[model samples]
Target: MDISIREGILTPDTFAGLRAACGMPELETALVGRAIESSLFTLSAVNGSRTVGMVRVVGDGAFVFLIYDLLVVPLWRRRGIGSRLVEEAVSRAKLFVPPGRAVVVSLFSAEGREGFYSRLGFTELPAAGLGAGMQCFYL
Candidate 1:
């Protein structure tokens, strides 16, 4: 299959479908639309016209970027689509910072998925003397 990764062409419906296929809870269509519009970068993996994978980056556009909502349809999982999406997203996020300046690109890997990101050069926190990463989610 020829999977083509494109930027900024994701629709709410496609986003929701990809989310569902990855076992995530359904989100409101309006919320998906707003999130897509606000994301710093968004990439969708397409096989012909179907969206089989996606990833989003959110950040301040200068110093910090957090990758979020990376998902690929189950049938497509072992084919390197997720890795490609992440590589592209990180590449674009780095462009937001000026040369010689440092930028942090981070993500919270889903449980049991840390190895996937690690292979792509992400280090888990609490190593290297840094504290464990923390988060507070809205209930």
Candidate 2:
């Protein structure tokens, strides 16, 4: 398959397809649609005319960067697309942070995927990051 990565908002038709492909829970389209327009960085992998994979990075453009919505279609899952999406996000993160304190990149992965991220060089934070926050509510 010929896969090309493009930068743009996720189209409405591809929204459900992409969400299901990535195994993400359903979200309101309007909310997601609004985000697509405001996203600072987004990469989509397309095969011919089909969107096969995608990932987005949403943040304040300076202090905080969060990785979100990474999903490769089920048919394309094991072909290193997921990791490529992550690599792209990391590369974008580099563009956001300068040489001073530290850039914090965080995400909440699904149940069995923590090991997958650890394999990708993400580790459990003992402190100073994930450990520094207190949650009021979770959905």
Best-performing candidate as measured by TM-score: 1
Query: What's each prediction's clash count?
Result: 0, 0
| TM-score of every prediction relative to native | 0.94, 0.81
lDDT of each: 0.91, 0.77
When superposed on Cα atoms, how far off is each prediction in RMSD? Answer: 1.3, 2.8
lDDT of 1 by residue, 52-110 (tens): 99999988898779999999999998999999999999888878888767678999999
Model 1 residue 8 CA deviation in Å:
0.3
Q: Which ten residues in a row have the lowest lDDT in candidate 1?
A: 94-103
Model 2 lDDT tens row, 69-96: 8888888878887887887787778777
